[model samples]
Structures are given as C-alpha cells and as structure tokens.
Target: MSSFDLRLLLDPPRYPANRYAPLADRIKRLLATHANVVFVQAEAILALEAVAISIARPGRVAVNVVTSPYGAWFGTWLSRGGAGVHQVSAAPGQPIDAAAVSACLERLPQVDIIAAVHAESSNGALNPLAELAALARSRDALFVVDAVASVGGHPIDFDQHGIDIAVIGAQKALAGPAGVSGVAVSARAWAHIAASPDVAPSSLSLMDLKRNWLERGRLALPGMPPPLEFWALEAALDRVEAEGIEHVIARHRQAARASRAGLRALGIEPWIARDEAASALVTSAPVPTGVDAHTLIADAARMGVELAPGYGEIEGRLVRLDHTGTRAKFDAVLANVTAYGTALERQRVDVDIGAAARAVNDVYAAR
Candidate 1:
C-alpha cells in the first residue's frame, strides 16, 4: 500500500479527550436526556448487553417485551444473569401491545425491571413506548428501551417517558458507522447498577463504564477507542443537527407513509397494517401470492434495487424496505418503489409503476 494509505489507516493519532466529550454530549442531545451517557467502543449489542449485565441478578424480577428476536435475546441475557425473567411476547411480525405489558406488570407486581424494543426493524413494528413506560412507572419498575432503530425516525423523550436506560446505535436512523454505540442511564438506573453485586468489571459492565466516565471525564475514554467510528458518529450528528432532528423525523414519517402507499398500489400491503404499529424506518410487506420473497428480492436487485428479506423465522414471507436517515427522501423513495413495481411487472404481476412513483413524489411534495 502507498504511504498515504498506510497513514490514513494506521498512523492516525489517538483521539483527544476533549474530542470525546462533545460526541457524548451530542449523543445526549440526540437522546433528549440529561442522563449519564457513555459511548461504548463496540457495536450496539455490547452496550445493550452491558445494561442487561448491570441489572440482572437473583431476586430481581424483569419483564421482557418480545416483538422480535432482539427482545428474546434480552430476556435470555437477563435469565443467564440469574434474573427471574417473564417475557411478554407478541405474535410473530407484530408489535407488542401496551395491554399485554400492563397485564404482565399487574400480574407480577414484584417486577423491578421492564425491557422493550421501541421499534423493531426486522418486522417493521413499533411498540407503544409511552404507554409501556407509563405502566412501568406506575409499577415502580425501571424501564429499559432499545431505541437503536427509532432514534432519529421517531420522537423519543427519555426523561418524559421515565425510561431509565435507553440504548441506541449509529447504524440505523443516524446513518453512521455501526462499530460504536451509546447508552443513556438515568440516575435511578445508575444507582441500581452501582448497587448491584452481580455487576462486574468486565467489558459488558455498565458500572465499569460509570467509573471510567467519572475518573476520565469526556475528554478521556476508558480504553482504546475506535477513532474512526467516533469521528463518523460526530459527522453524522453534524448532518442531523443541520437538518434539525424534528425535520428528520418528519421526513422519515413521510417516507413511511409514501412507501406503504406505493407498496399497496403495487398490490402488496405492509405487514404492520396499523399506522400506529408501523415503524418509520422500516416497512415490511407480505410476499404476494405465488411469489417467493427471495424471488421478489432478486427481481428488485436485477432492477438495481436492493431489498432486505424478513429476518429469521419471518424470512421468505415478507419483504423489508428501509426508509431512514438519508434514505428518507423523495428520490430514494421513488427509486425503491419504482424498482419494486418494475420487478412485479417482470413477474407478470400487474402494477402501475408510474402511479406508485407519483404517490411517493406526491407525499414528498405535500410535506
């Protein structure tokens, strides 16, 4: 490799401590929280695991809300840490209902922790966060939300909702690098983590991060930080601030509305039928009769459009389309919808591609 390439990849200096604080502060601003924020030098799953490790232990009762596989993983992580976990699971490809969560809290008043995913991209479903958070508060339980996919696309008021721990990633609506993540911990959540004897000094320990935050401050990171990811996150935040967070959210909403309408016009209704239950970032639609999801996806790809299939068990049954961050634009929406409609036409499925494209443009123009 050339010297320039080597210098760019390996010779970069360690990031300054002052540089670190601004990133964390920007992330805190994005979360709309005054809670303690810690930037983890790994993917979001690690930060999420740290939250689970900090709270799960014997005698602690946790209610895990399962809308998708990520929720199931949270319950498993808590269980492995010896917490008594009761999972409130929704039907496959469906968002968890607030009623189900309320019932769980009512039946198990001893529940001290409530965990849920705010929006699941895998199934394109959005859980009732404010309702669930209210229930958690009424039950005096600490509410933990995985807002990885919802952060920029949806409005999240961590303090208003009484969410004790909110974990977010850069790869989704933020349109940033995936190598780093952050978590906002409320005072109550920190207290629990600080008091928990099960909380260790491992990489997945929130208490350790807390200690690092206190001693090193924002200028200094705990360990060797991924400078590249940190810089990427900072750039992404700059773009978000430039566009205004609320406008970004509105764009995402419009994208979701247009995408769903276009898909319906192409004879494929979104999987999350209800508007309230659908996620702004992702829209999953059922595979039409006599057409496999893989075939449909391949057809779209041949038209220069890439589409994601349903995750895990739901694979082959649904086609997943994303409209988050940079993708939440008129051109991107029009392109994806046109590609899908064209693909269906290739399969001899009748669809008005022009009309579908017009629908997307109309929504963009309306807003």
Candidate 2:
C-alpha cells in the first residue's frame, strides 16, 4: 500500500463506520456468548449511566459497593440517573466481602441494581466477583461490574458470574487506544431497559444503540465509523484470542508473583495485606523509611523506569507498579525491578539486589 493510503487507513474517522456495529460485534465475540453487548464512545462512565438508567425507578434503590476510585464515580452517576443510591465503602487495600453485600441487600430490599468494581486499579485490589454476583443474583438485582482493568488481565466469565452489565475499556489490559469502550449486556438487562420509563440522552442511550445497530442492519445507519480503530480493535481481540485468555491470565499471575516476591526480598511490604485480594496487573507497596515514594518514582523515571506514584490519600507514601498492557514482558519487569533496587541503594536503603533478581527468577523457573 502507498504511504498516503496507509495514512488514510490508519486514521480513525470522526464518525464510526456502521455506527460502531463492527467493533460491537468484535466485543460481543470476546465476551460470553448469548449475551447482548453494546459498543460505546465514552468509557465505563457511559456504561454506568446506561445501567443506572435501565434500573432506575421512582422508588427503586441501587447499591454501589466501592473498593476503588472508579466505583465512587460510578455511584455518583447512578445517583444522577434518579435512583436512590446506597454506598458500601471498603478500605483501598481490602476487597468488599460478598457477605457484607448480601447483608446490605437484606437491609435494603428495594435495591434493583448492585454495582461493583472487578479490579480496582487505584489500590491494586480485586473484589471477589463470583461471590458478589451470587449475592446479587439471590437478591434479584441486576449485577453491574466495572471490569475495565480486569477483563483481559484476568478471566471474566460474565455469564457464569451472573454479570448483567459488564463494562470494559480498551486502554488498560486490552492495550488499545482510547476513545473506544464496550459493555456486555445480558438479556435481563435489555428487558430492564425496555421496561424503564425514563428516557436516556439520545447519544448515550444503550437502547437506541441496540435498536439501531443490533436490531436494524448496519447499512441503514446515517454515518460511518473510523475503520482504522475498528480494525485495530479487531486485531487486538484476535491477538488476545490467539494467545488464549487462560494464558493471558497466567502471564498476569506470573507477573504479580514475581513483583511481590521481589518487593518482599527487598524488605518492602505490599500495601494490600492479602496476596489473593491483590490484582495481578499492578501492585502497591509502602514507601521505605526515610525514602519518599514520589521522589523515588520521579528518580526511577529518569533512569528509564516509570513507576506510578500513589493516588488519593496514599500519595507520596506508596509506590505502584503497573504491569498491565503490552509492556508486561518478563525482561521489562526484571529491568524495572533491578532499576528500583539500584535507586534504593543510591538513597542508602539497604537492598540485596541479587536476592531481588533471584526472587523474580525463581517465580519464572517454577512456572
């Protein structure tokens, strides 16, 4: 192909071709079969809006169990959609127990939708989705999950888990560009939307998208999408399927194990007390005594190892390692860990560099 033609093919159009049906189909195939899925322009926020609108009624209540930053924002969106919102807050490093959620449901029998985060990127905590979904199912509430960071990094069986509406974005574990996001909607969720009296905003309406793209053929849509992004997403999904979701999840597990082992060997304790609750895609560690996490991260960036500083109240006190995306290669991880050890040594923090390397190597060898 000519350079100009390649450029044209590479650019995403201002409007989506087929009003995003092609991308939607790709997402549907990635998610559980026999589920009604939708593709949207806005991120998980849009999906949250759709879910909230679908379940909202004059006296109906929605419960948002928050263990991460995104869940809090999603709670706000739910409230604005005209539902009575109840929040169950958990500490950043801990996962909210399913028993607690069930208890909440018992107390508030009017809750029609139960929203939770699958993997919390802010504190590297992952909630027990299977348990939470079972609790929601027992309560007869629509289970809405924000799996943006967890879907590709971990195994998410939407149907098996009773996830009625699951939202995901492309930028995190999917390693795709921004501006595209997806949602897996169960048949029950569509029924809820169909029965709701509230009218959603034209562009943000899931029902409208479903009627236009899914019920009606794509050729009938008014505008066309950017073929490049659609094609890119298709290719990315193809790559993920080729690698196998199980293998992808295993790789993330290996990365997390290596990271935690290395950090412990360096006398660094993970922020989350339980290793099982922590996500494989990222890890958070307390700053060493006499060393500021913000300063260490800044210094590490200069050494070509970019580490995420802590968020919210933990800022400057914790360091986070994001092993998500295409950059989670074993070699890159080893290099980053070694660089961190070297940085700590320069600051007079005693670290056995050999031990750190060995810890990571041992994890890889065992696998």
Candidate 3:
C-alpha cells in the first residue's frame, strides 16, 4: 500500500464534532432505550464507574448482585460512597439466582438501589434481568445494570425493563472499537443522582457529563475527542443498522446454539445447560477431569483458533469458545470446536473432531 494509504491508516481525519449527538441517537436505537443516552469518551468501565460514584451515598442501601468480578467491583464502588451494600452471590460459572436476590432484598427493607450485571462475559452466564428489575420495582429502588457484555448479544429493552441506568460497549457483539462507550440514564435515576452528596463536578461525574457534553448540544467532547475511536464506532453503528439489530441478535444466538451442538459432539456438555441462562457471545464447556484448560487453550491457539479460559474464580476449570462480533460465523464456530477436539485428543482424551465439525456445519445449515 502507498504512504497515502498508510497515512490514512496512521493518521485518520478528524472526527466531526457535529456527529457526536447522532452517535448517541444511534446508540439509543441500538439499546432500544427511551432514556437520555450520554456518549462517554472512555471505555464502558468509565461509564459504569461514573454511575457508581455519582449516585452512591450514606444511608443508601443497595442489593448488588455478584456473578463475576465486574459485579463485585460495582458493589465495592457503591461501598466507597459509604452506602450499605448487600451482595447476593452465585457460585462459579453460574448466573445470579433471582430467588436468592429477592430473598436478600426482602430482608433489607431499607434498600434503595438494586445493581446487577445483565450478562457476565467472565463466567459466560446471563442473569435474569427482568426478575432483578421487578425486585427493584417492588422495593422502589434504582435499578442499575452493567450491560457491557450483553447489549448486542441479548435483547436489552431498557425502557421496557424499567432500567434506571445502563452502560454499553461497542467492542463486543457490536464489533466496534474499544475506547468509546455509552450510557443510558433515566429521569428517575437522574433525580436520585442529583440528590446524592457524592455527586461532584469531576470527569467521572455524570453530572458534569450531562451539564457539559450532553446539554451543550453534544458539540465537542471537553477534551480533544479521539478521532479513531469515534470514527470506528460510527462505522460500527452503520453496520449494525444495515444488518438490523434483530438480525445481529439472532446471529449471536445461532452461533451459541451451534457451539453447544459441536461441543456435545466432542463429548463435552456446555457449562450452562439451559440456553437462556448462557451468554450468546461465548459458549463455555467444563474441562474434562485432569485436563488443564490453559494447556488446551494454548493447544487451540497453535491450531489458529483463539480459545479463552474462564475468568477469575473459574479459571482453568472451563474452556470458553468465543463467537463474539465478527467471529460469530460458521467457519469460526467450526474452527473453535475442531481445534478444541484436537487439543483434547492430544491430552489422551478421545474426541471426534470430524463429528464435531460436522455438527457445527449441520447446525448452521439447519438454521
């Protein structure tokens, strides 16, 4: 390629300041949200942390659900604000139990906020968002969601589900860049945040964000907005609109189903037995007894297939075959299962690679 092309790659044109508002509008469409959506210049974590710091305060009690490290982090943030946090946790590689969460909330009549992650990429588990939201409704608590991993892979109707606050990233199923993210804030949530003594005019403050960027006509970000992340995010939005959001969701769902069938052909059952409880972005299976997940992951990588080991507490206990974003295709699914089978066979475990590949092919074909 010429230097002109290289320069274009190396030094992209300035992203239009006028287009920032439209980007937030597109995000609203993507999220199926009726709330005021704020475009955050940093990663989804920034938006998530902003919610925690801006709203938490003394005398506020929240029922924070814990399924992965991210959920635990949110609880910690809530506590740093001097709020009393009651965590309802689930075991490794499992989704948060809705009944358990309801029970916990019932014990605490003073609860004013309910926090939960919509889906945990770490454990490959999808929580019951509606149930959690209902619990919040019953208690009249602010319902905040860490929807980073589930936004595009699953249907998250923010308004329909009564979500007070939600954070999203484009890097996962949206196939966008990593640096930029968005957050949807409801009117009720905004009022509660304004009442919080913890609220201050900081970069992490949603109050500052709304007062500066969002309210100022979304003209230009306070700092020099990154051109590359913004432009890539716009292109991602274009792709999602062209494909239709429903189709994008269906693509991930089909990928997960195919992964499950292929893993079964290789004689490994999926970690989460039910389809609803599992994440569509990745399919996780238990590593056979005495078989190391990291070793299998390395072996699969040698075969040109990228496999992920379970996060944190479940590390080395499960192998995750990700079909996230562009990888949610038939070829990628086939390669993932076949490579895993090859690795298992190398470890002296019997596996039918051909059968696994065929299983993936058949599933996609049938769909």
Candidate 4:
C-alpha cells in the first residue's frame, strides 16, 4: 500500500458553511461590481442560464450575440424562458461585430435585454464589450455578459460599464474549482428578473439566491453547498490577492504577447489576427492542414506543456496555447511555443523553431 492515505484526497479540508457568503463577496470585489452577488453551487454555465431565465419573459425582446457554443446555448435558455430572441450570429468562433448588433437593434424591435460573451476561449476571440454596452444603453436595455473566460485576464469594471447581469466562473483565469461560480445582478436586472412569473424555483434560480442568500444576511446557501469547491475557491481568491490582481492580469497579457510573437516567427497565424479582438486567456491558431490537433497537442503534453484543441464545432480545426492564472508566465509561454514547434517538426512540417524561441525570449527580455 502507498504511504499516503487515499481517503485524504476525499476529505482534505472542510469549508465552513457560513463563509460561503464572504467568499461570494470576495469574487464581487474581484469583478469590481456593485451589483448584488449570488454564489451558485453549480458551474458558470448554470449561473448563466439562471440569469437568462430570470430576465426572460414572454413579452421581453432579447438581442443575443452568437459567436460560440456558449453564446448559442445562452440564447437557447432565453428562448426556453419565452423571450422573443433576435440573434446576431457571426462565422463560427468569430467575434460579433458591433455594427451588426446596432443594425439588428435598429430593426424597430424594442430590445429588453442584450446578451453576449465578453471573450470566447474556443478561438481566442474577444468580443467588443464596450461597443455592445453602448448599444444596450442606447436602447435602454439590460446588458448581460458571460465573462467566464475574461474575468482575471481582462479588466471588468462591471458597475462602471452598466452591466445588468454578469456571470463569472472560477475555472478559467481564476484557476479555481469548476463546480462553483457566481453572478452579479444590478437593481435594474433584479426588477426584470423579479417580474418573471416562471423564475426557476430550484437550484438554477437567481431570484431565490437573492431572496434566500443575499437578502437573508448572506449566510449559508439555500441548498447543500459543495464544500470542497468553496474551499478551493477561497484559496484561489487568496492567491490572487497575494500575487496582486494587476500583476496576474499583466502576466496573462505578457504570455499572450509572447505566444503571438513566437507563432508569427514560426509562420503560424493567430486565429483572431486582430490583436484587439483576441483574448489574453489563450492564443489560438488554425491547425496546420493534415495535422491531427489532438495528436499534436498530446505530443506537446509529453514535452511538459499543456495545449488544447478548439471546442464544439471548431474542434480539431484549431490549436490553443493556454495562459491561464498560474501558467501565465515566461517559462510557460516559452515552453508552450517550443513544444508546439517541435511537435510540428515531428509531423514533417518545416518550421523555424529556433526563430520562434528567440521571439519569445525577446518579448520577455524587453519587458
């Protein structure tokens, strides 16, 4: 038998039930939001769905931006909640154009809510958040953002941006457990959510979280909370504070910058060519023709670098270099680029691996 007890992994630490509210507050501060914060026991997607179901009603009109599967699923949730949906879809894994959204809004429909993703990790696309917010404000509509991928990598001044409902997850840039997530809801959003006659009554209900948790002194959650996830989340918050949030964000940006530079030196093009439209969370590029992405990424993993393929519809078509939380460092960035270049070499692709390594080194040295 191994010296370490196996049971320890199952019961490492116990998270205090009462501290869940305080943990939620910590996430609120991370978001820089003044909105009412609700901690959900499930992952971010459920929190997103609850937000949509809460705001959607039969008479409501929503302009939903579809850039990836996550945004598409959000629109489905709104539709299921009886909202009249006007979808502004882009090419798969592409950011929605602000002009397209405005043109859609000008079609004489009174939009009650505007739903979009802040950044899409699937193809490293960063949506036009400010422009989308401005369009929503012009129509006097509630702006809902799924910031699952952008929270720590990008600055989110939630209240300052007038975001009515912003959904966040800990797994992406926060480097926390995937099981626990939170949402920030503004007063205007509450008014709309409270008006929904069919607001979810069970766990996927934001209104209940507000009434049962937020208004009731922010103690324990209504349902049984996941203790391990809460404990891990607390640790993540502590780590962020220790590292300084600004430094953490800067690291992700630096990693992205280096990865992009290295990719260019190797003759690989970023999927989102425009730096302005790409997210710092991950650097993505189309998979080289005839190269199996899974095999390439798996090969990279053997070299001590973690690489991922695109999600859903874009799977196998793109390869991504993640720079999330702890991995957003010069070493990680260099290793990622080097491993990919080497993996490509193994596939008989002529790549300038030496130049790519130099490019990554130059970026960090200059910084």
Candidate 5:
C-alpha cells in the first residue's frame, strides 16, 4: 500500500480534548436525558457487563429477563456475581409478556434490580418496556435496559421510564461503528454502584468510567482512545440530528410495515404476530416448508441482497430482514422483498413477485 494510504488508515488524528465532553453530551441529548453518559471504548456487551458487575452483589435480588440471548447472558453474568437472579422468560419468538413480568415482580418484591432487553432483534420482538418499567418503579428497583437494538429506531425516554442504566451500541440503529458503545446512568444507579463493596475500580467498572468523566471534566480520555470510531459515532449522531429523531423512528416503522406486508403477500408469516409487539429494527419471517433459511439467504445474497438468519437455536428456522438505520428505507424494503420472492421462485415455490412488490409499494405510498 502507498505511504499516503498507510498514514490515512493507521495514523488518524487524535481525538481533541474539547470534543470529549461534547461527544458525551451529544449522547445524553440523543437519549433525551440529563443522566450521566459514559462512552465505552468497546462494544455494548462490555458496557452492559460493567453494569452487571456494578449492580449484582451477594444478597441482592435481581430479576433478569430472558427474551433474547443477550438477556440470558446478562442473567448468567448476574448469577456469576453472586446475585440471586430470577429469570423471567418469554415464549420462543415472542416478546416478554407484561403480565408474566408483573407476576415475577410481585413474587420478588424485594428485588434490587431489573434487567431486560428493550427489543429482541433475534426474533424481531419488542418487549413491553413501559409496563416493565412501571413494575420496577412499584418495587423500587433499579431498572436496567439493554437498548442496543432499540435506540434511534424506537422512542426511548430513559428518565421518563425511570431506567437506572441503559446500554446502547452504535452498530445497530445508530448506524455507527461496533467498536464504540455507551451507557446512560441515573443517579440511583450511581448510588447503587458506589455502595457495592464488590465493585472494583477497573477498566470494566462503571464506577471507574464515572470517575474519569467527573475528574477529567471536558478533557480527552485519560488514555489513547480510538479516534476513528469516536469520530464515526460523531458523524452518525450528526446524521440523526440532520434528519430529526422522530422522522428517523417513523422511517424505521414504515420499513418494518413494508417488509411485513410484502412477506405476507408472498405467503410468508411473520415470526411476531402482533404489530405492536414486533421490533421495528428487524422483521423476522419463518422459512417456508421444504426451504432452508440459509439457502434462501445465500440465494438472496447472490442477487445482491443480504439477509440474516435467526440467531442461535432459531437459526435455519427464520430469516431476519433488517430495517435499522440506513436499511430503514423504501429502497431497502423493496430490494429485500423482491429478493425473497425471487429466491422462493428459484426453489420451485409459487411466489407472486409482482404482488409482493406491489404490497411493499402500497405500504410506502401510505407512509
């Protein structure tokens, strides 16, 4: 490679001190909160683990919700930290039911913390965040939400929902790099972390991150941070600001409607039956009989359209059509439905490509 290329890729300018505070401030603004914001130098999983480590201590009762794999991992993390975790699980390919959560909270009224995923992209289901948050409030528990797949695509008011800790990833609905992530922590959460004797001052400690922000005040990070990813996140936030957040959310919702309508027109059923419970970030559809989800994904890719198979155990049973960030567009919806229809036809399945395309167009037109 040329020297210019090497320097451009390897020696990007360092993040300026003045921009650090603004970056954190912008994230707080995006979440529509005055809560403390800490930008993690790693993926959102690390930020969430930090929250778990800070909150889960011996003798604490935490209700860990398991609607997706991430929730399951959080439950395991809490258990490893000596917290008594009561996992409330939803049926496969379904969002967590408010009634079940209410029952769990009622049974464990002494719970100190509640952890849940706002949207399960794996199954394209949106959990009842408002109801769950209300339950946490009733129990006086710290509400922790994994908003990785919901932010930017769905409406979120951290303070309004009484969310003590919310972890977000730039890679999903934010349309940014996976290398950077963040968390918004409420005063109640900070207090919980400060009181935890087991909470250590480490790289993965949320307390350490909060200290860095308070002590450093508008200065750049203590160590060398990833300039590229930070700048990319800034650019992504700029885009969001340019197109109004509400409009961005509406676009995502519209894309999901178009994708679902198109799929239904092709005789494919959505994994989530209720529109209100489905995630706008992604639309999951079951693979038709005699057809492998992987094969369909491969066929779609060959036609210049990429589709993701359902995560983990659900793989090969369903296909996920992404509608988050840049993918939440009319063009993307059309391309995805057309690809699915064409792939079905290639497999000797009777699919009306014209009808599916028209359905998608109709949805967009209605929007």
Candidate 6:
C-alpha cells in the first residue's frame, strides 16, 4: 500500500464475517502472529475484571504490585472478584522491582496470579515486565500485565516476557477513542478462565466471547460492539504493522528523550525518578514554585496546544505529555515544547525559551 492509501485502511465498513469481524480478526491476527497469545477487546478495567475472575480460586491469592492509581484500582477489582488481594507497594514515580515482587510471593505462598503495570502513565514509570515475569514464572504464578499506555508506543514481547495476560487501551498509544481496548491472553490465562466455575456477564466474559466469536464462528451479539472504534483500532494496528513495532517504539523513545531534554533545559525536573522513567509518555515536573500546573496547561491550550493535567491527587500539580498515536512526530514535539515555554514565560516562571527549543531541535537533528 502507498502512503496516501494508508488512511483508507482505517475506514469502517461492515464485513460478512461478523458485525465486529474486522476488529476481532485484526486482534486475532496480532495474537496469532505471536506464539501462545490470545486477544480480547474490552476496556482495560473490564479486562482486569476478567483476569481476576479467570485466576481466582477458592484458596489462591492474586497479588497486585501497585505503583500507580490504576494498579490500586485493579487490586480492588481482584479483591472483589473473590481472590485474596495482596498489594505490593512501590512509591509513585518508581516501579515495583522483580525482587520486591518475588519477596511478596515468597511471604505469601498462596499467591497464584501476579499483576503489574508495564507503564504507569499516571507517573511515567515503566515496570520491568521481562524481569518480573521471570520472577512470576519461578513462583509458578500467572503473570498479568497492564500495558494500557505501553503497547503501541513501547516494546512488549508477550511470549518472550512470559506475560500470561496483558491489557491494552485505545486512547493512550493507539491514538484511538476510549471505548475500545484489548487484552492479550496466554494459554495459561485461558486455562485459568476455563477452569473457573464463576459465571460471568455474557458480554464481559472472556471465555464466552472466545467461545462465541472465536470457536463457535458466531458474530458478537447485536449492539454489543463499538464499530467505529474497532475500525479505528484496526487502522491504528495497520499503521503500526506498516511502520514496524520496533520503529514505532524507537520513535516514542526518541520523542520522550527530546521531551525530557527540553524540560530539563527549561529547568524542569520530571516528577518520575530517572531510574523508573518511561519512554512511552511523560509526566511533568512537579508544579514549579509560584506556578500551578493547571495554569500552565490552560496557557498552553490558549496557545492552541492541548496538554493533559495529572489525574486525581496530582491534578494541578503536574501535567502529562503524551508522545503516542498519530501525533508522535518531531514537529509535534517541537510545537509542544514551544507552547510549554511560552506558557511558562507568561506565568513569569524562569525559562530560557530558545534553549528549550534548541534542545528539542538537537534531538530531532541527531535523529
């Protein structure tokens, strides 16, 4: 396909395979390309619900390694699903190390499933899944990962990393709408789900969805799928495939590097510690002295640049810089930095505008 026609692939159209056949097929293709992987599309929270149900047993425990708000929420979901939830805590801006997880499991012998976030978009921390997955494997526990903000923008090797179940969302890195997200399930995860006697909501049940849509060769129930979002996701996936996942990941890494360099040049330190920093997306420096993060973001918006404020408690204290999806470009990076510099200047925060731009330029030039 030519560059011009790339956009055409994103167009939504009903196909004979099923109402949501195109999306299901796309996800299946992604999973089938990787050994021992199964793909299910649902909100990340819903996916976690399934994972909780799939893995929960009468006496087994599910351990959630919390490094972000999402992890805490998932832990609650696991607990509500009848699994004993063990929270292994890590400070914000840092990741839960594999050794820490291993220690937790060692202390809690009943732990059967290990859940963690691959990238905590809330704090811009990237967990070391490969290492953690190995640790989980050593303990013979199912490794469940939340890759919501990492999948399209970072490197994730389900088979190589030994991740039994990895959840992804559309809005963050895929550059798609929020309603559609997906989860990749390993054979082990499927087995866990299959063995469970707990009844699942028909639409929310991973096993039911798999049976109807995948094994039984039936379309999803009417009014049960997000057609446009699915098409958009397929389009996004096609773009990723064309560009190559490695190249996509490298681009995000480069953009993140440029963002950090620019921020540092402007005398801004990232909220996240250097060791656990994520390349998929960036969280802003803590609110500068005498300046509010909300004001900075508002100023950027006035300058025609959109930036997200930190969610929950961090709101107005930090900003989030997303370098993913269709907007992952050097020009986009330059524009964002320029807008930020402008905003800071307006707020009377000490900022060397030229230097920040130059720092980003240097990274782009080197690339």
Show the lowest summed lDDT stretch of 10 residues, model 1.
Answer: 1-10
Candidate No. with top lDDT: 3
Q: Candidate 4, residues 1-367: lDDT per residue as tens digits?
A: 7899877659656577688767777878888876778888888888888888788889899999998999989999999989999999987777889999999999946899999999887778899999999999999999999999898889888977889989999898888889988888899988888888655477767888888878888877787777788888898989888987788888888899999999999988888888888899899877899898988988998998878888878898888898887788888888888899999889988889999999999999997
Pairs of residues clashing in candidate 6: none
- Candidate 5 pairs with clashing backbones: none
Identify the superior model by lDDT, candidate 2 or candidate 6: 2
- Give TM per candidate: 0.95, 0.90, 0.96, 0.95, 0.96, 0.87
CA lDDT of each prediction against the hidden true structure: 0.86, 0.76, 0.88, 0.87, 0.86, 0.72
Q: Report the alpha-carbon TM-score of model 5 versus the true structure.
A: 0.96
CA lDDT of 146 in candidate 1?
98
Ranking by TM-score: 3, 5, 1, 4, 2, 6
Candidate 2 per-residue C-alpha lDDT over 231-295 given as tens digits, one digit per residue, 9 for 90 to 100: 66776777787887677778887888888888888777778868888888787777778997767
Question: Which pairs in model 3 have colliding backbones?
Answer: none
TM-score of 4: 0.95
User: Which residue pairs show backbone clashes in model 2?
Assistant: 13-226, 15-225, 16-224, 16-225, 17-224, 17-225
TM-score head-to-head 3 vs 5, winner: 3
TM-score of structure candidate 2: 0.90
lDDT of 6 at 64: 87
Model 5, 15-68: lDDT tens per residue? 787897888888887788899888888888888888888888889999988887
In angstroms, give how far residue 44 of model 1 lies from its true place: 0.2
**Model 6, residue 293: what's the lDDT?**
79
